[model samples]
Target: MASFPKSPFPKPPFDRQKPQDPPGRDADMDPRPDYGEASYKGSGRLADRKAIITGGDSGIGKAVALAFAREGADVLVSYYDEHEDARETCRLVEEAGRQAIAMPGDIKDPTHCRALAERAAEAFGRIDILVNNAAHQKTFESLEEISDAEWEVTFATNIHAMFYLTKAALPHMRAGASIINTTSVNADTPSPQLLAYATTKGAIQNFTGGLAQILAERDIRVNCVAPGPIWTPLIPSTMPMEKVKNFGAQVPMKRPGQPCELAPVYVMLASPESSYVSGATVAVTGGKPFI
Candidate 1:
């Protein structure tokens, strides 16, 4: 019955700036994202569940990690060497009275992806949810500006790694388990500047739909979350400064979404309440139509 007021939309325009690299830090961003640190009240929606989330150190992944912990689920936070961010996420998870495991490695490597699943299985005894949320992206003016290596790296990190992790985790997952992948709005409306990244997201949607059917008999669910321009470190680190300043203006809401806004959808998809919901793409795109 208790509720809180929602944050107003169309956030004040951000100042132009650039972040460090492919995977940026939450602490370094100007006006850090609201990852539901002081909010996100939970009521045991995923009690005692065990989940593995890639890119769980910051951004949407971190938000989901915190939400899951608050909802009574133990979480394994997989990240790409962002030790401080990962530690902070783990601390928050612990504060919620849930266990958190921080695993730092590149999911781009299939071997490392399998190792992540193994580590989660070893620590938790079983895997109830798997969120493939880590990604790589860069902006280019023209097709010629995108190199062969960049294209391959993008696919490896975005889509290939999801395949590897899913394959490794399927064996450990039981009926009623959930697999949530982080796709992008670009899957439906591709961004020319992000050719490689968008292509991989498109692949993720197709993969989610196909996998859901294959696992139907086992009662495992497969779904994806498609986000629009979210106020995450990845925006400044990958896009041009001008683009970063006006990140979410193109969306109907005229403001970028915070990572926290996307966490509840993940909670629902991973909850038993969504047992009948699979092979679906849930879009959290700030009032933007996903179809």
Candidate 2:
């Protein structure tokens, strides 16, 4: 019998230093993430397009901003309060030889979300892509530990904000526009400790599909990307320190993914390269099964 082909991927240099934040810290993370600003060559995949990305200040959002800039799009990064992170992301975008604007505000409010869309449009003269990637999650020991405030805030940040921002952006978007939402692997995996947060993520998946069909006639595509455990500031900022150390080990790959590795999917989904793809969820989880 012929032996199965050997896997080609080499062992990743996994660093085991304890991440400082509950969600994780991009600045102090061992083996800093790949930004691809200098190396990723673009054939103008998103040239002349303008993009607005929520939570673009740090983590996966920051990675996507830099990638989009490299792909020839002017990027508007909407962030909450991480000024330093936002500035760093802006610098990377500028380094890509594209324009980047860091707009700081709370996305949970409809007015702020609308303003972001409008301002991005004004600054770039058009809005072609929207990436709803900002999210907040807190660990709970049990279901009862999830308070009403937590539930509301989670939905506000994760789901409601997406709805509000997309609605505001639609008018400015012409045919061939794209909207990308950031869901999570926990949506399908359903962690008991993250019941509320996972619920919002699952809603985002269904929301993406339903909205895609509604916007199909207008030629605006909607989709979601569900990432597995990634080394981002959110891990150190939200999870227990010890759990943060072993965050991605549960995946089949036995290591967490980096934000840079997952950034291309955003570009693919946003660019004309994925013209026929919509109502889809691009799974970037390391070896995790997608349902």
Candidate 3:
């Protein structure tokens, strides 16, 4: 087992780095967010399962993908334009003796989402798990700072794509399959600076709750993971430098969560053990109450 610090970060106040475009590169991150490359050990919980994970390029998505691969699941890593990060995720999956397919495109587009579903069906023969883990976020200090286009794109990338991809993937999903979405603490406690992103996260929680019931009759489980401040590429790319420096200080742990810390919960949600669990939001908030 790999030992971790109290904060899961190298230091309390992380060193400031250059501003990156949306969905920053993990390689360029100062601390290089851990994705359980060395610590994670699997026990065939998801043996032979087929899974599709959006945003599998880095952070939570990458960590989940690694855990799934280690558990003997074939993974299809769907990502945006982050080829380098996506490639590394695929390499990890392959290293675990599982099939890995790197498919890159914009999930904001409905057509691309359908294509992702079709490709997964073609490659994996069927879809056993769909992880709607990709999202786009850019912080705005005030309501006025958020433009009309910005508002629309956040919804498109965060919530709308989840709908489209879930719809497209359902046809291939069988009973006992799982759909795990990545919501956030922002869904419960909206962040004023991330108004648009928070709004979409709320929508996602609603969507997850409703869909869980709708699919329950079919025996298909639906759930979401609500993470607190996590040390992911999304932070530095979207939030201001000051906020980035003090990231996760608000939580009781007074530190951001590492991506690897979230893998076990995802593994439980995807495996057969969660057969009776649906419409549940598992909060990985580093000791912070999710409500």
lDDT computed for candidate 3: 0.93
Candidate 3 has its poorest 10 consecutive residues by lDDT at 4-13
- How do the residues 118-220 of candidate 2 rate in per-residue lDDT, one tens digit apiece? 9988998889999999998998998788899989999999999999999999889999999999999887888887888899999999999999999999999
Ranking by lDDT: 3, 1, 2
Candidate 2 colliding pairs, count: 16
Give a tens-digit lDDT track for model 3, residues 83-150.
Answer: 99999999999999999999999999999999999999999899999999999999888889889999
Model 3 residue 108 CA deviation in Å:
1.2
RMSD of 1: 2.6
Tell me how far the alpha carbon of residue 174 in candidate 3 is from the true structure, in angstroms, after superposition: 0.5
| Candidate 1 Cα misplacement greater than 4 A, ranges | 1-6
Q: List the residue pairs that clash in candidate 3.
A: none
- Report the Cα lDDT for candidate 2: 0.85
